[model samples]
Target: MIQRVIQFWRAINAHLSGSDFDFINIYLNKKEQNLFFAMRLYDQRHVLNVAYTARRLAQKDGGSINEKLLMKACLLHDVGRTAEDIFLFDKVFAVLLDKYLPKTAHKLAKYNNSRNRSFWKKRRHALFIYYHHAAIGAEKLQKIKLYDIAEIIKYHHAPPKYGDCRELIILRKADSLN
Candidate 1:
């Protein structure tokens, strides 16, 4: 609960303070920039943290990893969370539903496809994305021809099958650290 509150406060602060995109300009291409900016400010800040952490981890790991791809994966890993403009209460509810009533949460999330829904309906949809953002982000990345990055994003929250993906492991660790 305390962690969640801290995360919420940090997200609100990040949204209010606007990120300095200049720092990451050299790392991302035009298309990537557009996608990154399309996300809500809270998510954008989170992505920046994740990317920075991933890069640092890579450098500390002896420079064997492709730092660029790792950073890209980190930047886009939570892109799916941008599917809706979620508020703090919605996020808390989503977490609770995901933890205790997962099936119901999934059902509610899948039910609303129209953007013209009521506030509560939209909240449900956002909750669904929160739980399944990894796969959704992977699909988005795949559409942009970033197959390797997409694979890492897809399995960031879960263990990969082959279990030998060093980049995925590093990304997961970095994500958790931030």
Candidate 2:
């Protein structure tokens, strides 16, 4: 509950600081930056926070993680959820719906576009993006030849299975916190 409040607060006030912009430029190349910037400002801010948290978590892992790859993975984790797919209200609605009524949320989370202007279609699209952003992001990364990073993003929201990589673990932890 408190985490949702924090997330809501952060979403409303999301913006990029100068240093955040610099950090993004340093870690992402031109193509990567395009993908990152394609998201809404709120998501950009969230990813920046996740990247910092991931680096801090990696530091405590005794140098076993690849910081660069972790940072890149964190920054581009939500590239699948672009500004076009969701808005501020839609994000809030998706979160609340998924939290209090997951069954309904699932019902609305299918990918369909036959009735693009229908009320249900709008809600469905938002929920779809909410639930499937990780896989969508992975496909985008793969298209850009970022297969290694794509694998990490693909399972960022998945439950732990055997033999998860150090980077994926760190990314997921950081993502959950922010």
Candidate 3:
């Protein structure tokens, strides 16, 4: 509960400094950077926090972790939530709906093809994106030939199972922390 409030406050005040861009540029190339920047500023800030937390978790784990790949995956984990698909209000609405009324949220998340841009469809689309952003992000990354990173992003939100990769575990932990 406290963590959620802290995250909300941080989101409202999210901003990136010049050095943050320098950090991002270190892990992402021009095309990847474009995708990263396409997200809203709050989402950009969230990914940066995820990347930083992921690196610290990797350092603590002290295994044969690919730090570069981990950093890249963390930075682009939320790349699916672009400005268009789910804006600020949609994201908040989806979060609250999922938290308070998960059954309803699940029903809405199931996508139905509709040509009209009605309010209900917008809510449904937001829930769908919220639930499946990882897979959506993976597809986008695949289009840009980021197969390895896409694989990590693809399962970032999946349930933990036996033989999960160290990078994926770290990314999930970091994401939850933020």
Give all candidates' CA lDDT scores.
Answer: 0.77, 0.91, 0.89
Candidate 2 error regions (>4 Å)? 113-116
Best-to-worst ranking by TM-score: 2, 3, 1
* 1-178: candidate 2 lDDT, tens digit per residue: 8998888899999989999989998999999999999999999999999999999888888858888899999999999898988887888899899889999898878775554557767778979999999999999999999999999999999998999999999999999989
Tens-place lDDT digits, model 1, residues 26-92:
5778877777777888778888888888888888888478777777788878876662546556777
* Global CA lDDT computed for model 1: 0.77
- What are the clashing pairs of model 2? none
Predicted candidate 1, C-alpha RMSD: 2.4
- Give TM-scores for every candidate, taking all chains together and pairing residue i with residue i: 0.86, 0.95, 0.93
lDDT of 1 at 126: 79
Q: List the residue pairs that clash in candidate 1.
A: none
Worst 10 residues of 2 by lDDT: 111-120
Ranking by lDDT: 2, 3, 1
Candidate 3 local lDDT, residue 114: 63
Point out where model 1 deviates above 4 Å.
Answer: 15-19, 83-85, 160-164
Cα error, residue 124 of model 1, in Å, equals 2.0
